[model samples]
Target: MKKTTFAFYRKTMLTMISLGLLLNCSALTFAEENSNTDENQQVQEEILVEQTEVLTEEVAVELQKEETVEQSNKSIQTPKVHFSIYFVAEANGEVTGQTKFDSLVSSDLFSNIVTAIPTPVANEGYEFSGWYWGNSYIGSTSSEVYSYFKRGAALSDLTITAKFKQVETPKVHFSIYFVAETNGELTGQTKFDSLVSSDLFSNIVTAIPTPVANEGYEFSGWYWGNSYIGSTSSEVYSYFKRGAALSDLTITAKFKQATPKFNVTVKFVTEGKGSLTGNVTFDSTTSDLFKDVVATMPTPVAEEGNTFDGWYLNGSLIGTTSQEVYTTLENTKLLESTEIVAKFVENTQAQDPITPPTDTPTTPPTAENPQPEQPVINEPVEPVVNNPGQAQQITPVAPEVQDETILDDATPEVINANNLDTIEEEVTPLALGHDSWSLINLVLTLGIAALAIMMVIGKKTTNDETRKVNKNAKVIGCITAVISIIIFILTQDMSNPMALVDKWTIVMLILGLVQVVTSFINYKVKENNEVESVNC
Candidate 1:
């Protein structure tokens, strides 16, 4: 054989072998694909069989429900609401009524009420409080027609109880008389009547006694006879209850003599055509008596050749001296809100000049109560000319006299709402003179309650919009809590930690802390839930 022929045959055999190997691989792949297809078909058949079984079960359930409905339709009758009326507190009554879902709708509520029952009669010395349907007070109605069932309640077996309570008897009258300087002297300014009527064991409500302010004597604590009532603080509020034994309520405000000093207001009131050297209003101070208070009378500048006369006190001639200072303090009857007048006579001396006399007394400016500027406050007009072109000038009374504010820092404001008595007549100590504090407390309480309600509403919300709003609620709650805490801090004195332990402060603090903690916890829980959902 030839070499070329042999080579060609070998190459052909090699090609055939390669082709057969390729075909075997293709066949094995095809067989595997067929096996996979069979398995897939089997799985599909099983899934179809499960789906058919589910459908069949659902159909059966629906058929059963339908059959039940049909059977119920055959036996269905008119729906009647059941209600049982029972007497409470030894009362007797018979009540009967029928109510339906028509009463539940808002449009048909009033028209659908079946009020045909009679009210219960209570025993002697007892008054019916009200009827309780599902443990709710619906108010007491003593008419012949009474509602056996509540108007908008669902059709369920309800028990209505007619509650009765003992009749309240009138309280024995008593007097809450005050003793300051003397008995019943300042009580006339108060609306607290002598014939006071209250409950048998009600609390004793005393108006904040602040009107009796003495010049040198400080107001001490109130006393019942010799016994001292608690809390001598200037802003102390009463929370004491009245005793069961009725008697005259006498609260005495004893004043210790803090100082022997006194302030006297000396007004040079114009009686007979003369002008003072300065403003008519003046202030002078003295210890113990009027003689000690040497109030220098302003030199009188008489017009039309008139002469200055001697000063007179209560129509009696005081003295002709420039500085009239009495030796003994007891001789000077000077006290709070005292005024003095110096008269000017017409030509006491014929040779007197038009100007003020040389012997006329002149008041020197003191360091404490310095003479104010000549022009009055809010002055729209020119400076007052008492008499045309006179050396002594007097400030004319303003169209509206600007009241001067005299501050006694030693004495606290004891006048409460009872002084004006214009505020709400609430019985609580907090409302006595602290209406603003009370209002702040009320607002904080309502805000806390609202935040709690919002939290509960957002607790289980799942909608995207609703969840977003819920997330924002935490921020709002946090802000609200912070505000409450700030208010608590600002309102309290915080000197003694115990001083800040009032009812409002405690309640607000607790509520604020709880709000912050719960809001943080809620936010964290929601974040964790979101993370878990993302991971899933």
Candidate 2:
């Protein structure tokens, strides 16, 4: 800009000097060439000579600029570029401070250097935003302004624009919190990493985070309130949509301590016709790190004609009780395979089992009176006994049962294999060694008692008769007591040999003992009477 102004002033001053010299020379020439009158010559010379006072109204600055550019183009080889900055219709700022530079100049070498582009001013109620080329904001002034003009070929006319907006207002950012219980945590959350992105304020949406629980614990679920939501997995998508309002609220991820459940099984150890009580199995167990149980156990049930003996734990019988209300094995024990069973024993108090009559002859037949052969039972096989080929029925004795209670009358035995050739005789279904009473044994005991009663009734007592009667009674009582004791021992369960406190066996035993005592008393009385007779 300075160079252009200096050039203009210098050319104007030189033009005035050249005109002054020409005027002085032209006045002298006009006086020497024509020796006419001073007045006439003066008029002619006045027209020829130039005046010293110069007019100031010169060529237009725009015209001078054009002429200077044209002259420079012809002299210089550098290409020209037209650079400009202006405001668009929507711009709310002043357009005055557009950039200024020399109108006509060479390249950067000879041109006035431009420091920076002036920023546009904004109207009241508005603020200057930024300078934009088209759609991009390039700030108040272009950084490339230094080189913006020098590099472009073809007089670059860049029409830069500016934008403005209402005065500033405070802005708010978004954040969220996903907190877990003591033993749990969010899937990807770390102390350094944020729950939401870069503090986003709008259009905020994110995937629902999964919760993780430590060992021995389970992730109950995510909850907004204190109440449980009853879910263990995260939602398939985002919990909130893009347009939903978001805040810095917290959603709790709840967890629970894990517990294990065990399978419980209750078993019935009886088969004698009866209904059983108590569950066969239980799938309930404690929920803790340690093992302990406080549960009500199942009761024992016995069917009709049978009594509930007791409850059993594993394989051992709990005391001789009706039922067990709770578990016997607990606290670290019976944590795995546990078994509870209900034990039952049949009632044997009913007297006199009905007997099936056999077709045996009234008396043992001798060789003189040969009896016809008895019919075979269950088959047509002939008897193989050595004496008259007489076959005797022999039933097998049952073995002592264990673990499970066996039914006494399960099946009647045909005969012992060792005595297969013996004649098939009628046998009772109830065998010895079982807890039930044998029908044959019951009948034999009753017969002994009846025989003793008949012998004592309606008999006049002499000394010999009295002595014989007392002696016979003593022998009978001993036999009765021995037989009753053997039968009772045979019918006992070997598993619990000493548990034979049943009423039937005790009553029978006492009856035999009473008869023995009575015989002793009778003998004492007879001795006393004999002594009195001797004294008289």
Candidate 3:
């Protein structure tokens, strides 16, 4: 019997050990499953982050490419053109330094060309003398040469020379004429160059073209290159082909005797468009351009309330308005509009005063006069006579009374009563002040809670330890929430009823929300743990 019992005991011990081993294996399995799930989630998050980065890089590259294309397109369009004029002087049958042409043609020429011409003096020459009258024809002593050719005269070769003398005061006496044509026909008989006396004179005719009929042509101050040929001098010339429509013309004139003063004028005549005119002065030292020579509409006037808005030339604002008007001293061929706009400002009124109630004033009283006091009187009162006959033959006498005295003690009592009333009045307002203090306390409480949460999260030792750490963190969060509520209640003042109620209501609501969230999270964590245990 003893042997049998020993064997049964040993078998039971083995069964117990096996059950323990099975439970250990089950726990290990659950842990491995949780770790696998965590690793899979981390991989998914990394993939999402990488995709976002790649998309961002692609957008940046596309934007860079678009900018490069825009820059390339801007590099391909055409540039503006510029022109100049110079005058060559002849003294004693030889050419002196070149000078800028300064003679006034039509106001149109001055307005268009004179203003647009750059520096009148050439960098390589001495001071520039203006255009002289004597050099009106080829081979003349003093002549004006234009650097730019008219559209129709692109193939023409023109030569001009002028003569000057200092005898009996400075003068610009000279003569000018053009070689008739390629056929050797001279337009005017004038001995300009010594080479014209020989057979080479015919060569001059071949090199220059004769004036053709109906090809609009005009000479400066002369019918056909004819001018005052004596001692005094005039500068500049106007030459045009017959019937040729003049569009953009730049004329520079120079004088040999006197410096000329001139003004520019622009006139417009359109088939249906109304006429418009503008004028400005010319500076001998600068170049000018005539952009928008004619305006499509009449000049606008500034309204009563508005100042000059901007300037417009042809119907468009060329630039903003300033005290100084805009001027173009160079490149005068292009024409556009200058625009003007009117500026107006709005008016404003002053603020009104606010009045407070007389009974409960916000301002304190000044310390000038002392407050008035209530008065008290000391007097002896006679007994009532109505009951005098009740006592039989009672002697008529004043009731025995102590010396009448005005006691100052009652005055102190009355003052104390007033002081108590003032204290009661201040207490209510002070309570409202306490409500404000409660709000500050609430903020500090939230800060402490956030700090505690961070500390708990930081103390977690391992991935598996997060559950225990989170459980304790929830308790701590609850405590913090309760503390915040207590602080709000204690600091709340009912004297200003709305003050304490409004402030603490908001804080209580927030703390309640926190409590709800913590409770839900704790419940979820517990449920999740239970599910894992059951599955194992």
- Candidate that would win on TM-score: 2
lDDT of 2 by residue, 492-513 (tens): 3334324324445555646655
- Deviating ranges (above 4 Å) for candidate 3: 1-156, 159-410, 416-431, 434-467, 494-501, 504-510
Instruction: Provide the lDDT at 129 for model 3.
Output: 44
Positional deviation of 123 in candidate 1, in angstroms? 14
| lDDT (Cα atoms) of all candidates against the true structure | 0.52, 0.51, 0.39
Candidates arranged by lDDT, highest first: 1, 2, 3
Name the better of 1 and 2 by TM-score. Answer: 2
lDDT of 1 at 406: 33
Q: Look at candidate 2 and tell me the lDDT of residue 503.
A: 41
10 residues in a row with least lDDT, candidate 1: 391-400
TM-score to native of every candidate shown:
0.22, 0.26, 0.21
List, residue by residue over 24-77, the lDDT tens digit for candidate 3: 556556657777677755665565556556655655565566567667866894
Evaluate residue 251 in candidate 1 and report its C-alpha lDDT on the 0 to 100 scale: 64
What's the C-alpha lDDT at position 111 in model 2?
26
Q: Given candidate 3, what's the lDDT at residue 485?
A: 50
